[model samples]
Target: MKEITPNNTNTTNNSKPMQQRKRKADTLGYDLNLATSSGGETAEKGGDGPQRRLWVKDRSKDWWDKYNSADCPDDEFRKAFQMGKQTFDTICDELSASVAKENTMLRDAVPVKQRVAVCIYRLATGESLRLVSKKFGLGISTCHKLVLEVCSAIKDVLMPKYLQWPNHESMSVISDEFETLSGIPNVVGSMHTTHIPIIAPKVNVAAYFNKRLTDKKQKTCYSVTIQGVVNANGVFTDVCIGWPGSMPDDQVLEKSALSQRADGGLLKGVWIVGGCGYPLTDWVLVPYSQPHLTWTQHAFNEKIDEILKVSKDAFSRLKGRWSCLQKRTEMKLQDLPVVLGACCVLHNICELRDEPVEPDLVNEVVDDDDDEMVVPEVALRSEFASKARDTMAHNLLHHNHAGTSIL
Candidate 1:
């Protein structure tokens, strides 16, 4: 058990610069007398642990050679992993151009392609910043800054261009989807409100949930309501995120910009289909769920189901049990719905271009006895639907059915 001690310096080699001083071999043992007498050095011994070598080193170049080979790296596979290849590359170029224009303030030492490649690599692979830095030969701070800046730029530059209906043609495509509901056959589309689960902000946790207290298990997480509408084909037409889940759907809807469409007499005679949550006005009601509701109702529901399924799978990274833990990161729960809208736009484009898949239908007969057990408001609303039934009945009996099927 010998204590480690600093080596003695030699001034005899003063002719050489201090920076050129060579380190000496280490000596082991407690006897200082023997150390001083025997040049403070010990014989090298072979052991199981890694050897402390003085000069030996490996300078292998084969790995680099292999990496450079065209066939070795599998560029096609790499391209596939990089989602939206051309689109992502375009954003990367845009970011570089923006940074270049700001060069009077600052300039980047890293190449634009490397910066773009690294940011997209981290996002697509979900790797840690430190790991990405090492892989990209970037400093940790640079890796973090580049990724954040690029993400912000990509969101700003791409969202308005790709995630929305830019013209009446796109709006018409969306409107066609909404018109698929049976009761509201002419209804352009339906709106549904969903939530992105979030941890209740510290002060609002207890008060955020409903007072009914029916089942705590079913209502554990706090969330924010995201209102969106999907067309008859199931493409999301409009999306508004950020309202707290504690708010009522109508309240959330009222605060939305889309609400102006309903209020400004924009939808007065125009056919807009929606669930029961929507009021019966100049717009149509899709019955949400009713027996007499058209087969289109089921078709629309099926589309919604597919969209949500794909969305959940696509952004599974944010699907946390609690909102607080999720919010602490760069991504927000509200962003999920925005991302979902983008996916819908992509889905619509894909559907329009791709050939259709053959269908498989399932048919089952319901018992007449099941009808008796249900109530009429539920039944009439199901069969003819409240909006269609009421509108037709009132028109025939009162106003001579002048505009019964205008939608």
Candidate 2:
């Protein structure tokens, strides 16, 4: 071995420490300048991967502007908004002032027309909030808020104007129309209940679960009932929604405000026709359920069928126009009622405006058979109502206007 000098020893010690540092750096993934130089050379030689563009162009503004332009054709407007341009403008004119007044104090608030348009598009198409937000160029949470706000406004303002209990004169007109349409006399309105499917509620999930098995494997679906009374024109005059699906139709009626009003003599002499799912009272008339019916009973049932068509058609038109009601809406259980109520209001608006119904929507209406709940003996014994039904049946069989055949 060579003799160890101080300088040599110092150099050897420094080299060992430097080598240990390099090894530690390598283990920790830290390059010792060689890798850095190699990377720089590769970049300069154009061997680096493609660079990603960071900025994306937003196209929502162009889409929205195209749809909302004044020169936009009426047909295109109808396709998007589900209403004619005239109707849309009318509604916007009515709602714009109030929406503007409400948003007067907020800076960077969305325009009223845009807000209303977004809400209507969401309701009309039943698109998801995320999709609608992307289409309208809005944040998801903002879209939800705008939808709720606009629906509340519609319920508050348009509902009273469009959907209201008919007064004496209005009832007379509606009754005359019904008689002309179906030969059903003294009919103020036709009543029916439809199930609006919903997501299972966090609270009282069982209450929302419909006892009627909707699937092949006996799986019960959840729904809420919307009991509506429509006039001969298929316009809803009275609506009672938010009832749990598990509740029977008669129970829903019994707990309804209409029932209370009818019981308190407020609806005295005003008769409304209901299906077999309802209890026959003096004000509410139902068809005879007994077997071996007479000619008069058969005639009565036929006329009742004709009258009930008004309600069925109304529901069809409603669900057709607002497809959201047809689907299981992804909304909170409590919020669903408001959304549905708004749909009803919009339905009446469309009907009053004579908006054309789509041909395919007519086939979408389901002819659901109601599971009749057993009525108590005491409740079924309505002698006066029974006599009223008999009298009407007798007249229908005898008169036979429009050559209505009982065969």
- How much lDDT does each candidate structure score? 0.43, 0.76
**Per-residue CA lDDT of candidate 2, range 1-407, in tens?**
12222234445554666556656754543423321121122111232442212111222556678888988998888778788878877877777756653333212467888888888888888888877876776656667888888888888788889889998899999989888876767889999988888878888988888766365226667899999999998999999999998887888898998999898887777689888778889899877777798777877888887888789789988888777777778888778777888889888888999998786875775534334544434455478888888888877777774225756
Query: Candidate 2, 101: how far from true, in Å?
Result: 6.1
**In model 2, which regions exceed 4 Å deviation?**
1-59, 101-107, 213-218, 367-381, 402-405
TM-score of each: 0.49, 0.81
Model 2 residue 253 distance off true place after TM-score fit, in angstroms: 0.5
Candidate 2 RMSD computed on C-alpha atoms after optimal superposition onto the true structure: 13.3
Clashes of 1: 15
Model 1: per-residue lDDT, tens digit, 1-407?
A: 22112342444544244223222211111111111112223323455433222221122324323433445444442332233444444555656764432222222255666666665555444566656655665555666667655555555665555445324565555444433323223445456655444555665565445322214335565655556665555445566776765665556666887777667765544444444444434453433344654444444444333333332322221121111212323344434444334333333433333312112100121111112111223222223344554554343334332223322
Model 1 lDDT vs. the true structure? 0.43
TM-score of 1: 0.49
